[model samples]
Target chain A: DAGITQSPRHKVTETGTPVTLRCHQTENHRYMYWYRQDPGHGLRLIHYSYGVKDTDKGEVSDGYSVSRSKTEDFLLTLESATSSQTSVYFCAISSSGGTDTQYFGPGTRLTVL
Target chain B: AQSVTQPDIHITVSEGASLELRCNYSYGATPYLFWYVQSPGQGLQLLLKYFSGDTLVQGIKGFEAEFKRSQSSFNLRKPSVHWSDAAEYFCAVGTTTGNQFYFGTGTSLTVIP
Candidate 1:
């Protein structure tokens, strides 16, 4: 499990509402990533943080933002929730070593009505 | 662009039957490959990874993968399928420099009684 926990394991929100999902890791890893899993899409990277306060956009970064103010916490926020944004969000962390194998959190299922 | 391809969207195998899931990657350089499994309502778990050394890599849950550089494939295989093995499998490729990974659409496996 890599000591990773995601808050709000399940959430339901109305359209136009803002929602934030938090991923916390105890290992103090250097890399943290936010990904959304959907049918036929597998998992798509929304954003990732390589270091504290150092974040970068991923292939599907529109309408989503991430912040890593501290090493142990990474937050993903949806400015305005939409039905299309409903999916399972996962947080993963990888060590600074070159292995590139990531440990994933359980995941958060979000529904936008 | 680096990408992963899982040709089969779904597969069915009888319990105790041998199983193989195909994965092909498109990358320019020597790539880092990985296999992950996701159960219902659960997070993705790392099965195994191939970086270098021997082409055959062993993973958890009685799973193993072989990396074929010539074919750009890292197919996951198991000698006997168990009902517990029913889940979605994903194949991913990472670049040499960055930890970012690209994942396949995933294959859903069904173990028949």
Candidate 2:
């Protein structure tokens, strides 16, 4: 298994509060992605970073932001939490090469009240 | 736009029975396909991927998938089903050049003993 970790394994925040989830990878992968998993909907990409300080928006980037200051750490922040943002968030890392296999972290469960 | 469709939302099968999960994709070109398994409250794990070469691709945990260009499908199959195999399965499609991936809604499998 790839060495990936997600901090704040579980969190509950009231609406309009700020929240940040962290993803750390020991494998030094160049590509890191943040995704949300919800019922009736599969994993949807929220944001991804191709390299340090390089980021891009995904299909569902609204209400979320990401940063990659260092190669090993990627952070996802919700500026203002909403009830629709309540879901399990997963972090994944993969090498820069052609191999598209992504190794995922344990995931963070967030609930907005 | 690239998208994936998993028609079966849920399926039940007896242990030792053959299993199949259907996946259909829509893409302009020959796309990269993948299958992943997710246990309850756990991160997604890659099962198999089809980039090029043989149409039949073998993956971890005794899983295999066949990529059919004519049908635009990448169906997952296993000779025998075990209780451990009961989980949610997602089919993903990606472009050859881009690293972004789109996932299906997923199919929940229940293995009855």
Compute the lDDT for candidate 1. 0.93
Provide the TM-score for each candidate, comma-separated: 0.97, 0.97
lDDT per residue for candidate 1 within A10-109, as digits (tens), equals 9999999999999999998999999999999999999988999998888899999999999999999999999999999999999852258889999999
lDDT by residue (B1-23, candidate 1, tens digit) is 88999999999999999999999
User: Candidate 1 has what TM-score?
Assistant: 0.97
TM-score of chain B in each prediction: 0.97, 0.97
Once fitted onto the true fold, the runs of candidate 1 whose alpha carbons sit more than 4 angstroms away are none
Q: TM-score of the candidate numbered 2? A: 0.97
Error of 2 at B11 (Å): 0.5
